[model samples]
Target: MPAEEGSGIHCRLDELLADRGMTLTELSRRVGVSLVNLSVLKNDRAKAIRFSTLTAVCEVLGCEVGDLLTVARRP
Candidate 1:
């Protein structure tokens, strides 16, 4: 599914992983999150994320929260 209409937050998981030559499966394993949950976040289908989950992902990706998510402008 596409991102929620009017929802401004954009997840940068796809770009970050791609830039680091990492796959979602590898990230999921490293971050201790299930592939399906990671996929939901990666696809921008997740409405919210737990802080622990966010921290884990950021740690594994070597990024800050701002690098993982952004405020997207609505067109």
Candidate 2:
């Protein structure tokens, strides 16, 4: 089934960071984003993200946008 708008999107920030042996503070510093703001996105509580932020994060993490956000399929 098709996911409702703004639903079923999952953030993989924590997992990606773990896989890379990186900390939230490190990412915050590298991406030039505040820890609190990155925490919101890390915990999947962010309602939206800016394109600039996304690009910065992807660059720091060496990942594509798809690696950061993914669509979860519902049965």
Candidate 3:
């Protein structure tokens, strides 16, 4: 069955960064987030995202949230 909205959704922050040839270090520097905190987002372990952090990421990467995330299948 298909996943429900926000149920099995996944973030693609790491993938988008990679596709753009950006390192997590560079993104952390640009986004004003610590490497460790950003790693949580990058590794898809973040329970939620702050609006400020989301804005920072959008600013740095020039992408809307939709461009960096997708709904994933549930197990």
| Cα RMSD for candidates in order | 1.6, 3.1, 3.6
lDDT of all the models against the reference? Answer: 0.89, 0.89, 0.80
Global fold similarity of model 3 (TM-score):
0.81
Model 1: worst 10 consecutive residues (lDDT sum):
1-10
> What tens digits encode model 2's per-residue C-alpha lDDT throughout 1-75?
115544677789999999999999999999999999999888767778999999999999999999999987766
lDDT per residue, candidate 1, 11-56, as tens digits? 9999999999999999989988999999989887788899999999
Q: How many residue pairs of model 1 clash at the backbone?
A: 0
lDDT of 3 at 50: 90
TM value for model 2 = 0.87
Off by over 4 Å in 3: 1-7
The CA root-mean-square deviation of candidate 1, after full C-alpha superposition on the true structure, stands at: 1.6
TM-score leader: 1
**Model 3, 1-75: lDDT tens per residue?**
114434455778888898889999999998899999988776666677899998899889989988876767666
* lDDT of candidate 3 at residue 59, scale 0 to 100: 86
Candidate 2 RMSD to the real structure: 3.1
Best by lDDT: 1
Model 2: CA > 4 A from native: 1-6
Candidates sorted by lDDT, descending order?
Answer: 1, 2, 3
